[model samples]
Target: MNNKPVGRAPNFTNACIVMFGVNITWVLVVIWSLWGLLAAVFLGLGVNHLIERGRVWAAARQAASIRRGKRF
Candidate 1:
């Protein structure tokens, strides 16, 4: 049984995370296509912030889990 993660999973979050072997999505592009540059710019900033927040949250959770002697 081979158990190993290739990379980050695909999600609606952002294309920054490579999945399998590629950057899965171009959310900003889609937004720009449907809307305009102004919308894409503003929404893109929000998404960037969300990614940062998610990183911080993940780090905190990982630290807590380690302190409790847990591993996944």
Candidate 2:
């Protein structure tokens, strides 16, 4: 039996794509106004931070489930 944990590569890829898209939109906004650019940067960073935190939380939850021998 293959007993390895599932990797989070797909989740990481999705996170990167989402962040990249947000940054691109922010760049466009920057061309419209300085304040918009600042807001985009701040919001983008905050969102990305939240996503990372969620990822960590999910991973921990999965690990706990595995320890309990619970299958999803």
Query: Each candidate's TM vs. the true structure?
Result: 0.52, 0.52
Candidate 1 at residue 37, lDDT?
81
Error of 2 at 18 (Å): 7.6
- Candidate 1, position 3, lDDT: 92
Model 2 TM-score (2 dp): 0.52
Measured with C-alpha atoms, the lDDT of residue 7 in candidate 1 is 92
Error of 1 at 58 (Å): 0.6
Q: Clashing residue pairs, candidate 2?
A: none
Please name the candidate that would achieve the greatest lDDT relative to the true structure. 2
Backbone collisions counted per model:
0, 0
Please give, for residues 1-72, the per-residue lDDT of candidate 2 as tens digits: 999999865458788889988987867587548666667778678878999999999999999999999964
Q: Taking the tens digit of each residue's C-alpha lDDT, what string does model 1 give over 1-72?
A: 879868986775554444522522466677778998888898868877998999999999999999999973
Please report, as a residue range, the 10-residue window in candidate 1 with the lowest summed lDDT.
16-25
Which regions of candidate 1 are displaced past 4 Å? Answer: 1-27
Q: Candidate 1: lDDT of 50?
A: 90
